[model samples]
Target: MRPGQRGARGRRAAVTERNPGREVSAAKALQKVRGQIRLHLLSHRTSVTASGTLHLKEGDVPYTATSRHQGTASVAIKHIPQELVKRKLLMINGDVHDVPVEVVLILKATGGPESAGSSAAMYLLDWYDLDQELILVLERPVPCVDLRQYLKEKGGSLQEHEAKIMMQQLVEAAIELHSKQVFHRDIKLENIIVETGPDVPRARVADFSCGCFARKGHYHLFSGTPKCAPPEWYMHARYKARPTTVWQLGVVLYGMLDGHPSFDTLRFLRNKLPINSELSQNCQELLQMCLSKVPKQRPTLEQLQHHPWLQ
Candidate 1:
């Protein structure tokens, strides 16, 4: 169930300061704040704010060093949002929650905000629009690493039991996302963050820049990783949300068990890479069902949640 939207009393004071005598609804006041907060914060930071630089107060600067730039996105740490703090939304791996932050800020800045709602699997804390670039503040799980690096540390492939635990969590996350009408097009190892500090490793799905709202029709334009795309995108040049998501889940599982990247669409179409036979029969069956060439043959997210392999 989605979190109940709580009215923010603080917004009234801010709204009344600007427009005296004019009463504004809490929703409208929140919308106004979302629109103005980014510009207000950016302008008050310094005399001159660099195009891509995130300047915090002295000794509070979060970024230490720089690295090679690949895509348009880059990572840097900074302060948390006071707005979010006011709502008491900050917590470490807490219960599932949602903040009533405007969707426009996230959607306009990141191109993907459909999945930004409450989910233990996602860590979208807050976001700001800096005109030239967008600033996204995500939750950092201490003593954690990406699933790809974690796999390498585990001798390149995870044991069936470990993989089963991780896959069960991921499938549950997928079901939650599906219930909220959020289709995360990219569900790969690199995008998944695993918290190793816990007794059992916990997985948190990250990177929703390729996400969109779940719909009934097929989507022609694919925004996720090319190699991990479903076969329908290659053969038919179109794919639906759930089927494609299942296909990507299959790719993630294949990567975890095989310790190698899954095949590209063309190679998968030709059946160049097969599921590892050494895996248990249930695991192999789930892989086969998910990696089916025909989208219709693949099990739904609900079925995956109840699959014998996961159980």
Candidate 2:
């Protein structure tokens, strides 16, 4: 996932104070990186970021360099990696030549905050910080496509079985993240990528730039895409982590099957289009439970996992 996923215009900045010291040159800093340039000036999708492809000479590891100038001091741009190092090497097909391991670059500003919680659910390969830039060396999921692009290839929507499989993996990932007290403020199709294997494709969650460590009764400020914000946030100006996550899950499920969001406004979510005959009965029930107008009425991740639709 990229920093520009979901609503970039409304991204929350790094909660830490800005570093006012003399900035280091990003290009000069990258020169010291232990890698060969495979692709120079790679086209980064977001204008706010610049990225390139790199090949680590040490282990023949392939990685992607995602970087952004601290220009405009964007909150997502301030998302740099913490010092915690966790490594995993997934050997797909039992062949080293196959897909490499998916290493997520979980970032937090240096000396910003303790991020033991946020990095709990993913692997941190390597990270570096310059005075004005934070660069991450992330393992790219090869032979994979983003959920959004995959949906487009499927004529804008997914089949029921395919949707079920993808959503199951995503739900499990969400539950694991929440278990670590890490709130992935943004969860959308764009943030998930599916590996295209010969038999079964797996969905992997990416891009923790908008994520933060949070526990019950701790998260208060708005931190995600406005469209995914729950009714409680709009009506009462505050929202809890669990309920809002459930709402975002509902929105993503709907988008997967319907090719678009279920509703655009709080009024619409509360008063209009409450039913969808296109989906199975259990699936519809799950959506209703997740998209409930009242946060208290929404299902917890535990309850959602036991739902019939997922089973």
Candidate 3:
């Protein structure tokens, strides 16, 4: 039971933009903030942000602080109930190293255009913006069993429909972002969120703080969770960062159905394993096609949508 999971149903709310104006592009609204909490944020084991989030450790309690984050000139202050207040916080660079998803890094990363579309890969939420007292809130991540956990729970077996549904959701989300020209450098089970609520478990892609906007060319990032990453991503981190997202998704889809990785066996010996054969050939082929090392050979999200398994 993660923070977002509600009941045994493993259901999650639809990952929708609840508040429309609630979105504040840290890039666009930079100078709008006011009242920076003047405090020396220090943490012994707590995590922090690069440009905004701060964590502090006091005696035995931990405090989480959101520095006027990105956007706005000067941020505002908001009131927090005594119960909601965490103590002993630490603040650092834009990294915000210690947070639920390390999302602060995306704020530091170059974001795509405001019209980046539904899958733009990231969004700026306006949670706390009053008198420096930040009201930090985050999106309700999708609540579905991660591949590894799913395998363990299912003993390495998943229905074809289940695997296809998950892959379709991820591919569609990627399509949305691609249409808007935003490149999500990282895509893995740890990052892919699924809404488990009775609402068809809409899968939402997340973690774009490390994404690319204008594509000055991949900068080789040690992004992507280890198991789901493409071989090229591991070898050439910076320059080949985002292009491999599709491949990662493929690997994730394969692992979901087969209970193991789809990459090279020797290289990924530590990662590779066997999987269940409870899926249709069409679906497996689709997964393998996406995992192709040749980026161009990977089916576009649009192409994937029309996949026979999906059809």
Candidate 4:
């Protein structure tokens, strides 16, 4: 919390921009992408929701959905419009011509309040609930794949430059999440999607079912992949928000560059296997700061973004 100079006011503004509390009309959202978008929901699959199982047709522009679904229909629909509008603006302003749209589907069981879950921005196209299954739709980046698969395809490790690009965007996205008072408890290779075909692929942090609103500095329970757990969690049985986030980012960076995580347990993180020697000294230093055994020693989100390696 004390690692960065970003003030409370600045943080508030950033949070306000993507706060998820903001509401967008579902009818209007449906109207915006009605003819252009199509959703194909798979049935009889064991998974509760068909979030990542989708075949979308958007006016001949096509992409699969890689989304995370949770309890609320509202939260599931909220992120869709923001993504579509974001990509549209980027194209209009000529900022990046080839940015991919992020699509998601929320498959929820038939009985839950619409507003009980995590925060979501207001954008609902259309959602249907039938036979105890709720199918929600959204968009995702095209010509891209999950980071886990990408790493495997690259023979376990990514080139330094590619890793840098992915981490930068990921760090930025993390900052945005923290600013919005959201803690993405699950930050791993599978949850991060890499936009392919660019000279340097961009990354987006996807999936929010495992996330929740950060209340104060303490979160009593842990709800994420065990591989990314911090040492403090194993020691004290509960983890704070910011430090846990820093530790997860470290795990992610290490996995990207080394082709695998250095440690999966507190005992192992305390004695993290030697970092890959191929990494530059600065990159290594950043990883050291992030993977620190002591929670307090870890960098804040703001500080991590400006770390020398990322710059």
Name the runs in model 2 displaced over 4 angstroms. 1-122, 261-267, 270-275
User: 2 or 4: which has the higher TM-score?
Assistant: 2
Mark the regions of model 4 whose C-alpha exceeds 4 Å error after superposition. 1-131, 261-263, 270-272
Better of 3 and 4 by lDDT: 4
**Best candidate, TM-score:** 1
Taking the tens digit of each residue's C-alpha lDDT, what string does model 4 give over 1-311? 11121121112112233543322333343333332232111131122221111222223222134354434421223223212221111212222222112222222111122422221221233443222222334334446687899899889988888888888887877776666455667688877867676777767666554555454455556666666778887777778878888888888888899876334755455565668777899999999899888888888889998888888
When summed lDDT is taken over every stretch of 10 residues in candidate 4, the lowest stretch is: 1-10
- Write out the backbone clash pairs for model 1: none
Worst 10 residues of 2 by lDDT: 37-46
The residue-by-residue lDDT of candidate 2 on 1-311, one tens digit each, is 33222111123222222532212332333333312111110121111121211221222212233333233321212233222212222222332211111222243111112432222233333444333234454444446677789888889888778888877877887776665455676677777767775477777666655455545663446654566678887787777777777888888887888776334546446565545687898988998898888888998988998899999
The lDDT leader among the candidates is 1
Write one digit per residue (lDDT tens) for candidate 1, span 1-311.
Answer: 01113233322223345654443554455456544543432232222111111212322322222222224433323333333221112122333222322222123222233443234454434444322223445656666788999998999999999999999988887876666556778788987889888899988777554565567788877767778889988788889989998999999999999987544657767778878899999999999999999999999999988999898
Model 2: lDDT equals 0.54
Residue pairs with clashing backbones, model 4: 24-122, 101-140, 102-139, 102-140, 103-138, 103-139, 103-140, 104-138
Q: Which of the predicted structures, 1 or 2, would earn the higher TM-score when compared with the native? A: 1
Q: Please rank every candidate by TM-score, starting with the best.
A: 1, 2, 4, 3
Model 1 spans with C-alpha error above 4 angstroms? 1-32, 35-118
By lDDT, is 1 or 3 better? 1
TM-score, structure 4 vs. true: 0.60
- Two-way TM-score contest, 2 vs 3, winner: 2
